[model samples]
Target: MKADVIDAEHASRVTKVDSLLPEIPVLNADDVQLVGDPELITVSVGDSAGSGLATCRSVPEDSPRSSWQALTEHRLELKLAGPEPVAAISALLDQWEVHLANVARKSDIETAAVIARPSRDTIGSAELLQHGFAPVVGIAVRPAERLATTGPVTTPGVRIRPAELGDLPTAVHLQLELQRYDAQFGMTTMRAGAEEMVTEELRAQLSGEPTMWIAELYGQPLGMVRVQLPDQAFWISSCVNAARVGYLSSLAVAEPARSSGVGTALANHAHQVLEEAGAEVMLLHHALASPQSTPFWYAQGYRPLWTFWQRRPAVR
Candidate 1:
């Protein structure tokens, strides 16, 4: 007999399976087709160790119910599909788990949910501690728009300009200050020494790896932003079909400059530089749990495209 098939839509029926076997590996089976919708495909797990079947489904419209139901009393797995599959699967997994425990009186399986199309290599496992499903991180692509205003509005005595090799000392100081903030927020601090930071950043800048801008108030360096030229591979994959793109990395504003428009100024400069460099799109990553930075970036016109999920299975 042919293996069971699932589409992005019918994948909902397999929520029970997801709740039961959360850690089961999800393989992209783009080759198999489902019977109902030709646009959807069934992912096949051939002789897998897990004792369950999972499929993807598509939901054409926004409705409470969209032609998918769980099969109880059977070991199964399911994966949801949509523009935002991570969030949808998370909600469905929660409901399915609750219903199963309330009715079946048995709970032995570990269910896991992950956001597909992750931007990075691995979503650290720490993301699973506070929530059942890992939060889906977002990436935004900003379009180039002519600036109606002039350069950054700096403090009365503040200065802004491109960082030079001579600014390494000041840059290292600012980088360390940023590192302190990261440590306070339980983020991993860069183990590289100041010399390393300066060397790497300077090398990148000198080689035109990234456009670097610095903010100085009263002749004292305050903050920095680095706008990297678009990678050929990334451009071909994401925006090649549209327009040129760039990636913003290492945007930092000192604590004292938080509300002083320093961050916004640096970002605006980065955007301007990117636009002038023939980049029509820009992307950046932020920790979903980082309250201080997430909202700030959102206010600057970035939106969610994808998220990373993390979990650490108990070592045997």
Candidate 2:
């Protein structure tokens, strides 16, 4: 079935399943469809929707894009829900495996991912693991109201300031360093021309939004973070129930500054800035396996809202 044609009963059932995880907003069925037109599979029992899955295929190599798009050439994002979600997911994967082997070009599609909830981590464990998928990343959220009222938490001798066009070199270098580090974990890829793409992307953000911030320690730039306020965060704001949301796009600390409180200062500053800008909640993504980020974000009061289980080179 086409995503747009999902019936009300199915949508309602999906929402019911989602209610199990109150932290995540119930995505409207209409908005569940990904960028490319997606195909959906509906599991039914006696005329009632028992489960559903929607798959969207994405090909980022078709056009010039941001360096972040280097992760995969062809990708598949799966949206699933149901009462017996595990069984339904297993069946869907079974069918997809066949389709991948018979019709799809195995070498072209690089990743297949499912956006799931941390609350349901064990629900489909066997199925997801059997299919070679691993929980790789998490989308974490923090309430902005509390932070807004809280006093600033700054490290001594560290100063945070808005990034300017003149800081382009430092910003780009830090971002690329982050990309390269993350690439080691497979979530990010440093493709040919990635440096140019990252430079261009950072240049635009620096010159336009005034949303990025740099952390300085004794006059040396050591950390940077890009946060988009509610207005600028509309792209992902709808994913949560908060009427006003903020996004922590990227946060990086130089190797020399690791564990020196630079990251903490940068993040604390982001909370203060975003909250002051009227953000009711803030969200960010982090690689689940990252030793540096997991504990840091948790300490900042962020918890996983959605976990992405992914398998690279889909066919595998």
Candidate 3:
């Protein structure tokens, strides 16, 4: 098929599928480049032709991509413009496998992933699982209206305070701890010079819009949470329908403070801040397999909006 005809078909199908899910917005096509020798792969669903597109992205270790982006060095992203039959989706996935074989070594791709709305999970789950992908992380969201009905999480003697320039050391330490814990689940990585990078990032964030907060017990820091207001969060906010969205960038409680409600207190504080700032929804990413975070975030009123199904080491 000609590239223009295929592109037109792919756009129509994508729009059709996206309109079905009011909660998940369509991904920007500009961010993904078309790949494969023929570029567009197609399969038949009954009488109509269904199409799929593949895009590969590489994030250098020093790339400006943030840590929350799943720290994988390279990614093979597969997109099927479907309200089509699962069989057609599966065929496209098969083509992706062949494409993976072609570029896995040369690109040094680390992971192959499909970012799917939770409502569509059953659509291509069988093929995704058979292709060695696991639902590794969830992009969870909490609506702003829910915040008004929720009360503060009270943990006596635990107080949340805004972070200042002087708090950089403690902030960086807690941030790295969060990264280290998530790394074990393979959703995040602590790269070389991570500390320095984190230090600089936090230093700037502390001085700016997405405020950082420190949780204290007996006047000593025990936990921290970073929240990006709507402006700073716009990049991720595009994925949701809300007019104003905020992000819970990072949150961590020290080992000694775990289960002591320090984490809950910090989260509640972030909720109040975003709600007061007029954010219509809050979003965050949590490791799917983490014993602590998965339940913690859900308990805090967030629900999985999207699931990132990923296969590590892209080819094998």
The local distance difference test score of each candidate is 0.48, 0.67, 0.71
lDDT of 2 by residue, 1-316 (tens): 3344334434454445443233334432332224444444445322222233444444354222323332232233334444565665576666666645643445553444444544335556678789887887777888875624655777988999999998889998998898888766655766677777778878888778678999999899989999888898887766666788889988999999998999988898888888888888899978788888889999998877667676666664
TM-score, every prediction: 0.55, 0.82, 0.83
Best by lDDT: 3
Pairs with steric clashes in candidate 3: none
lDDT of 3 by residue, 1-316 (tens): 3445545655455445444223325553333333333355666555334465555554556643435443332343333443464766677777767866766653333444554535334567877788877887778888876526656757899988888899899998898898899978767767778888898888888777548889998788989999988877877776776788999988999999899889999999998888888898899988989999999998998887777777766766
lDDT value, residue 136 of candidate 2? 76
TM-score of 3: 0.83
**TM-score of model 1 vs. true structure:** 0.55
Candidate 1's residue-wise lDDT over 132-186, tens digit each?
4444344444556655447544456556798877766666666666555544432
Clashes in each model (backbone N, CA, C under 3 Å)? 18, 1, 0
Q: Which ten residues in a row have the lowest lDDT in candidate 2?
A: 62-71
